[model samples]
Target: MKFALVDDIKTEAVKGAKGICPSCGSEMIARCGNFKINHWAHKGRRKCDPWWENETIWHRSWKNNYPIEWQEISLLDEKTGEKHIADIQANDGLVIEFQHSYINPEERFSREKFYKKMVWVVDGTRLKKDYPRFMKGKSDFITTNKPGIFKVDFPDECFPYAWLESSVPVVFDFGKLFESISGISNPMYCLFPKHENYYALIAEINRKTFIKTTLNGEWLSRTEEFLKQSKKTKLNRTFIQPIENTIRRKPSKYVLERGKWKKRRRF
Candidate 1:
């Protein structure tokens, strides 16, 4: 983990430093090496939390974008007595989990359920095939009426299958900020939770804008409002589809006017 409890305060790992794990209150010893980023380790390499994973340079770099106080937050479920350390919990109770390694579908779903109001910032550069597949699928991205928002037929073709069924927003970071690809600016793509007509919704969000809105707590509210409105729109479409289909297949061009059926013949 990035931060541990030292002197009753959250502190980063330093060489030969001893601290306490913020979540479990276990003894933590700092190990600073050239190979790995400086981090606190439990005795005998045992982990207090089962869900804890090794941090990567990409993960640490993303964490640095947010404030130190917001990083490595420990959350507990009072009813179930479940406790886990979140990567970042914003001021407005939004959890941001920066994932750089591969995770199975079950664990991913579990994390989403635990962090109800959360977003996943996945590192897309981890796997070579992932970026290529996404680029290939980008050709099929249908433009929506809304700016920067797109409609995708099969999101599984573009993103990892594990994330296609996520319950919250999943933001895929293809490259670091200022990293250009094919001479074009690389922006993070966010996949929304809901899908309509098997068409997934993805938004091309600027990295800086994502960070800014997320920091100021606008991202959560905006996402909630969008999902709410999307649900209404989808219901309206579903309700109107049958009527439109029936009218198209009616075969007879007749209209009820003045209590009598008026017929018109096709030419």
Candidate 2:
């Protein structure tokens, strides 16, 4: 993790410094290597939390965006007395998790349930094909009357399926911030899951705007306004065509089999 308790005080890892794990209170050693970012590690190479993953440069960069106190906070469950360290616990009780690796749906759901109000900042650049796959799925979005909100038919195939049914909001970090076809700047795509529909809210703001709006719980309101404006204005169709590729593909094998069975039973 980025910070450890040194003499009961949260401290960043420095060469030759010793610390303690914030969660388990175990002895931790600072690892300052040339290849990797400086970070604290358990002395015996053991992990206190099963959910903890090795910190990467990407993870560190995200943590650096917030204050040091907000990073790696230990949260307690009032009823169960269980504790888990959050990636970032904002002042408003919002947990921002920087996810680099893929975890099962169960774990993802468990984290969300424990945090209650949380958001995921997933690394879209983790895999080479992630962007292409996401773009393919985005192409099939069903426009909604709610402006920035949208309804996706097969989100399981288009999104990181683990977050498809997430109870809270999720923002996908597509590596770089650029101007969209609509002439709006965006740093990430926000996916808000409601019942059976996955609504994709394109963020028309830069990275700082995203951070600030999210912390203040104003992103949803901004999204609505952006969508309203989008409806009134005309976007560049040529630029939209790339991301809106319209080659309708066949359904999955399971879907095909289910359709066939339904047809046979009807006859």
Q: What's the TM-score of each model vs. the native?
A: 0.83, 0.78
Query: How many backbone collisions does model 1 have?
Result: 0
Candidate 2 Cα misplacement greater than 4 A, ranges: 144-147, 177-181, 196-206, 217-245, 252-267
7 Cα displacement, candidate 1 (Å) = 1.5
**Best candidate, lDDT:** 1
Which digits, one per residue and each the tens of the lDDT, describe model 2 over residues 126-194?
A: 777788887766677654443334445455455665666566677888766334433445656677544
Which lDDT tens digits does candidate 1 get at residues 1-267?
888889989988999898999888889899899999988888677787777889989889889999999998899999999998899999999999998888897898899999899999998878889888887666666665555667765566678877877889999998853433223355889998787765778888888889999999899999999889887765332222111122122233443234222354566
- Judged by lDDT against the true structure, how good is candidate 1? 0.79
Clashing pairs in 1: none
Candidate 2: residue pairs that collide: none
C-alpha lDDT (0 to 100) for residue 150 of candidate 2: 48
Model 2 lDDT at residue 162:
63
TM-score of 1: 0.83
